[model samples]
Target: MTVRVRFAPSPTGMFHVGGARSALQNWIYAKQQGGVFVLRIEDTDAARNKPEWTEGILSALDWIGISRGSYEGPYFQSANAGEHRAAATRLYESGRAYYCDCTREDVQARTGSQYQGYDGYHRDLGLGPGPGHALRFRTPDEGSTVVVDLIRGEPTFENKLIEDFVIARGDGSPVFLLANVVDDMTMGITHVIRAEEHLPNTPKQQLLWDALGVKPPVWAHVPVVVNEKRQKLSKRRDKVALEAYRDEGYLAGAMRNYLMLLGWAPSGDREIVEWSVIEDEFRLEEVNPSPAFFDEKKLRAFNGEYIRALPVSEFIDACQPWLTGTGTIAPPPWQPEEYDADAFAAVAPLAQTRLAVLSEIVPNVDFLFLASPLIDEAAWTKTMKDGSADLLDAAIAAFEALQSWDAESLKSTLEAVGAERGLKLGKTQAPVRVAVTGRTVGLPLFESLEVLGRERTLTRMRAARLRLV
Candidate 1:
């Protein structure tokens, strides 16, 4: 059988990390089997769905490199309303589904408030289609539903306890079960891989498929991603939005790598392998059955490793978007016209090692582009206290007389100045570093000074000397 998989997401708001994980697993499975992957938008929940949210899902997928070319479609589930209605009508006419004109209050009154689900009061009422009635599938009362999940192994549910679930609402609108099964059948989705939270709904969907007399797909419900508190990540409580991570300067490649490791681990000791390695080695059977923790610290660490692994030029290129700003991210302190590519290229190497995300590049090198650096008051006070004036003055004179204004000469000159002052280079360079870069911690001091030019360097040092007075 050709492995066919689909990532059917409901566009309620921001594209979530949980949704990304599911999509990625499906994509990996398809690639591993050399089969087809499909993107289906389950927009049947019209009240909560938005066009912008749908666009966000597609954009997020593209950002993470999930393509549509090798796949089938981003087919909208709502578009197949006619097929869904026809299926519902077929079940209703075939005695597999029946109209129930009972409300929650009626069921509770008949079966007491302790009753959990629909009591099936109208199951054999022999009622035809009418107002104030929902279409519920007549579940078998004697057998069991064996969900043969690949991840968790086969789990059986007693049909007696499995309530007669509604397939369509009172207004004749097809619910999730009907829409989902109909689309899966019509689209030929061979494997139903999704979050473990949807596992309970599978037995009901399987029953729907059986009622419709169509073979259901293989079900593999992976573990749900939870927060530090062990609760499922909620939009209100957790920063789980995938686009938010993108805005915060995370590389999409790193995000994909980190996300893939949430519930499944590769064979070897390393988790930072390339995408091709993952595609070649990924297996659904090896997925863990337990909950996966969405640990931000580990993800950040992974991102840092990926950032350092980037080539210098590509790192600079990646920092460009965050430097200028995109969407809600405000631009760096420096003006766009003030940005000097060659100067930044000179300092990019120093920033790359210190960076965990692309956004950190701006703060590390913003001093180079700004007309006047944003001086850190604490750094200035700490480095240029009383007794530091002579140090700054001496360094200014040393830098001014330099024949060649390069990193090597600047380093040697500064070291010589520190020696004359009876201080080590590390000790003496503190005041100079604070004076020039506005912070003691930043890109390498001499190299930054070289890129800033002799004139600007001297101007800042002299300005620092005068400020000490």
Candidate 2:
């Protein structure tokens, strides 16, 4: 059989990180097996689903490099409502489902809130479809439904404990379970790889599939992503949106790789994995069932590594959005005319190494574009607390006397000043560094000074001398 899998996401809001991981796992497995990776938007909930949210889902997927060429459809589940409703009707006519007129208050009156679920009071009502009745599946009362999971071992749920959940409302609109199962059966999704939170839904879905006489897909419930406090990633409390991460300048490749490692490890002790290796080695069976914490620190570390590995040109290109103020990062502190490509290229290599994300590109090199560095008061106070006047005066004098202006020339000049004052280069350069660059630390000082030119460098040093007074 051709292995087929689908990422069925409900387009209710922002495309979440958990959803991204699930989509990635499905995409990987599909690619590895030479199978179909499907994108199914289950957007039937009119109250919550919006067209913009659906667009957001597709945008997020494409941004992460999971493009249309790699997979089939973007099938909208809302478009298949007629088929879903028909299946629900078939279930009703086939005696697999029946109409239940019990309201929540009625169910609670009989089965108390403390009870596991709705009492089967209306199970045998034999009521025909009416305005007050909702269609419910007829779950077996005496047996257990076992979910044959790939990641987790077989777990059986007692049918008695499994409430006969509603399949469709009186208005004939199919519920999520009904629509989901019908869609999965029609799409031939061979493996249902998703977060572990959906494990409970497995037994219910499996039962629905069995009742409908269609085979249930293989289940692989991977671990749920948690926050620092070990709580499930909440929309209200956690930064769960993939767009949010992308906006913050995370590399798509890094985000994809990190998402893969949440609850699954690559071959051996490797963390920085190549796409080819990930495609070859990814297996749903190897996924862990334990919860995975979404550690922003680790993700940022991975991003830094990925960013540093990028070719200098590619690194600079990736930073264009941040540097040119054309993308997610807000308008850069400096103007567009001040953004010199050549200057940035000279400093790109050094800045690339220091950044964990592309957003850091601006702050690290903003000094290069601004008229004068935006001085950090604390950094200035620390470096210029004492003897700053002498250091700036000496730096201005040595730099002004220099006929050559290059990293080597600047290095020698600064080193001579340090030596003459009996101070180390780090000590002697501290005040000068702060004056030229806003922050105390940044790209290589000599190289940066070289790019800033001899005149501008001397001017900043003299400005620092005046500030000392």
Write the residue-wise lDDT of candidate 2 on 1-469 in tens digits: 9999999999899999999999999988888888999899988888998899988988899998888667889898988988898999899999989998887888777766855477777777789998868999889889899899888899989998888889999888888888999999889989889889989888999999998898899888999999999999999999999998998899999999999998988889998899778888887888888899999999999999999999999998999988887745688999888889999998989898899988888889988889988999999888887777987788888888888889999888889998988999899888889999968888899999999988788888888788789
After superposition of all CA atoms, the RMSD between model 1 and the true structure is: 1.8
lDDT of 1: 0.89
Looking at model 1, the pairs that clash are none
Q: What is the C-alpha RMSD of each candidate to the true structure, in Å?
A: 1.8, 1.6
**lDDT of all predictions:** 0.89, 0.88
Q: Can you tell me which runs of candidate 1 are displaced by over 4 Å?
A: 326-329, 420-422
Q: Each model's TM-score, in the order given?
A: 0.95, 0.96
| Off by more than 4 A, model 2 | 114-116
Q: Output the worst ten-in-a-row residue range by lDDT, candidate 2.
A: 111-120
Cα misplacement distance, residue 359 of candidate 2 (Å): 1.0
The sequence of per-residue lDDT tens digits that candidate 1 reaches over residues 1-469 is 9989999999999989999999999988888888889899999888899999999999899889885465688899989999999999999999888999888888888888856688888888798887767899989989899988889898899999888888888889889888999999998889989999999888889888888898889999999999999999999999999999998889999999999998898887989999998888888999998999999988889899999999998998888886777666778888889989988888888889998877888778888888878899998877877668998888999888999999999999989988997889898889988888899898888889999999998988888889888
